[model samples]
Target: MTQVNRPQPPVRIQSSRVAESIAADLRQRILRGTYPEGPLPKQDDLILEYGVSGPSLREALRILEAEGLITVRRGKVGGAYIHPPNWSSAAYALGLAMQGQSVRVHDLAMAIRELEPRCAESCAEREDRLETVVPALEKNIEASEDALGDGAHFTEVSRTFHDVFVDLAANQTLRLVVRSLVAVWTIQEQAWADAMEGEGRYPDIEQQKAVLKAHRAITRLVARGDRNKVGKIATEHLAATQPRVLQFCGDRTIDASSATAMRGFRGLK
Candidate 1:
């Protein structure tokens, strides 16, 4: 009996692997602000720079595009425009994940109930509350007040107050996380408002005024750096408001693909 050994052939690199490598490099550059001023180097230029085949380069760009990092345009004006990651993108991603899990409106509302109060507390703990948080919140409160009597409009304005309040939190991580949840919740709640308004069942003017008053009181507490009081008030405010939206939502799952939800992102930044 004779034993034979076969020589191993050279392994070919997969286009996906090459694309991933290129995507990794470009992703870091995008995050690092390497191409801050304009679209990324042209495809030809990137191809030359990376010394890869056109398909590999294109695949790499696709990868970045899918990650919400680059926007690939077409025709003469076509180039891969850089979009460094931000809160809205994070929120969209989070929404997708929640949607995939069939996360319900009430689940999101409950999670918001737990997380958003912490954001308010963080805002109150900021040393420059007067210069930063208070004014923004007060401005939003004024807008909310002005929109009173218009149910849908008032809902929109009041939601902005929460968005602004969360954005003012000093912790970047907490700000982003809470803001993402709020963004999702805002879409859901605003949809509820629009529907209820259409049905002539949206909250009354007095209820809207109560919401504005709560916002104003939260702002004052944030101004005084009353962290505990502001957090408590925020918790109470959310408790009072979320149920209406939740009742409309019932057991409905979070909708990441709703046309209304997609439109909502345009106003996020």
Candidate 2:
């Protein structure tokens, strides 16, 4: 939202230091696709490659696992496997930062309100150069329309709409920073949507229709070189929607670890 642990050095446990260095090297290898066929080079092969003992290599793999760059499995069928780098990991990291600084969901929403309109302005300018951009937003709105009454499914797709808009805005900094906020907020909103299910907290069709109309209007305005209109409309749309959703949330702070736990993990196979 805003400006976003250690162990003691045990006496002469050189393997711990070894593990960190090994994790760094293997992280690069996985990222660079050195192990393309399989998610990992063989455990025995890694031991040989790194010239380390089995325990040391295992320790390195554990470090990588905690960093979310790899998954380590035990048993005969198990081995360390590379996990792809992704926004969720960055989002989790951002959540951790926000947690340390005592950031609230309200702060995050405010940041989005401030920054996303800038993204809208940027999106308007970029749409002129990239003809496909507006169509992409249009597709998202169509999908949202189709999901009008399905709270769970709509929760996921609606995020894609916001994420795609931020992405197409043609600003790398906003894409990374804003979308990290987006990624975490979506995780929270998924849980929020479920909590709101029976209580009828989700927008009714009329409200949904109004939102869809606004998005469609925003899309049209952005297409017509109306950067100011894009920013004004987007900000107002978000401002209007935010309080309604937060009204249901109360004072719950977003905990990234819990969100990931609740959603469960789906690592690359």
Candidate 3:
């Protein structure tokens, strides 16, 4: 006697799975500049293009929105807006993860102390330092000098110096990683500056001058292409300056729900 095979049932894909597949395709398109002009094509258009139901397409948009890839607005003028991910998004995610793990502010400071100097060293190693790196840093130093007496303003300018330093580094991966850490640290430091100013304990002008001196020294080292000295100087400068903020933070963990960080995210392009 011979046995016969039964007919097989059609495989039905879940809406959620369909949504994920739709999301992946749209996500790549958004990231690759497919919709560079504006918010994604109208939802109706996307639904048509993907040949999926409205619910499935909407679910796909939801996934991208949650990942910071796009923003969906609801109104007569509403549509899903594309927001390509950048360093700030990376920083916000990093901040959330650190907050989830209860990572301390001092721990973040320590990580920056070790990592950022390498960025400075890399800046010194850049072949186009004169055209690309030095001018930006020197201009930032001038802003720092002008901001010397205003503690809060000075802190902001000084932080920009480090931001520019990291941005100028030749290593793209290190630049992004360090810059994310710096962005997170900037929120804390700026908050500390505000609090200290309120309490009349913000670093005095003399202390601000000292910071300027260190920044100038580091700039000179980079201009001279002295990678060895620039890294060492950067390390020393961070060591001296971080304590002013860290002392206020104590054992407090970074706040992922920080309104400042969120506000920064909102302004990202």
Candidate 4:
């Protein structure tokens, strides 16, 4: 795969919107061990803390839930409880929202170009830390190699490899954005993988190898603190892989700008 180079400043102009702020505060608290895996702070406590109403507090909790931070229970035992959030549900919501969106391979390429440099830059900053992310990347690479003959296994490992970037980026907002996009891409890619499975080419070991190689190279770049090189490699690697993905899937039918349609359909956003 030909590596393409794109560079971005480390800073991103993230929104300080109300919900985002509430979400950020709560995420910080959770990360700092304020919540842990116990019952969440009572709604009244949260309402008092934030000077918000029951509805607003509930909305904040919803964001937490969407991010996989808390489990809201009903019945006598039910209230919000702190737990690690999984990205899968959010990813699926993104997948459903993108289900009918009009997307071309090039549109996918364009979106990636916009987002990846930021991820690369962030990952590069944390690359040397190696406390959480780099090991996870390597682990997924190893897992992929072992799972090459299994279609279901390969799909999962591939997703994990990409997800490592989201974690490394370390920006909650960007993590959410890329995760949602990955969910949609996964759906499209899965379709292709399924088709390939039918032709006795179910396991594309070579494709996995290419993707793994790209990841390993990027990891090395990040470890070296070469932000420019990392960003370039990320863009090039992502863009070059489009044809490989498209070979297994078709263009998306719905554009993300019409995401409101998903809300109407689900009665939730």
Q: Clashing residue pairs in candidate 3, if any?
A: none
Per-candidate TM-score against the hidden true structure: 0.93, 0.83, 0.92, 0.59
The better-scoring model by lDDT among 2 and 4 is 2
Each model's lDDT comes to: 0.88, 0.75, 0.87, 0.68
Task: Give the alpha carbon lDDT tens digit for every residue of 112-224 in model 2.
Answer: 88987787788888735347668888889989989988876776666577777777778787777887787666666666777677667766678767778888888887788
Where does the lowest 10-residue lDDT sum fall in candidate 2? 260-269
- Candidate 3 displacement at residue 75 in angstroms: 2.5
Top lDDT prediction, candidate number: 1
Better of 1 and 4 by TM-score: 1
Candidate 3's TM-score reads: 0.92
Q: How many clashing pairs does model 2 include?
A: 0
Preferred candidate (TM-score higher): 3 or 4: 3
Pairs that collide, model 2: none
Best by TM-score: 1
Question: 118-228, model 4: which lDDT tens digit per residue?
Answer: 776788787454766667777887887787778755865666677677666869889778766665555556556666777777646677677778878987777777878
Sort all candidates by TM-score, best to worst: 1, 3, 2, 4
Candidate 1: clashing pairs of residues: none
How much is 25 displaced in model 1, in angstroms?
A: 0.6
RMSD of each: 2.2, 8.4, 3.2, 15.2
lDDT of 4 at 75: 88
Better of 3 and 4 by lDDT: 3
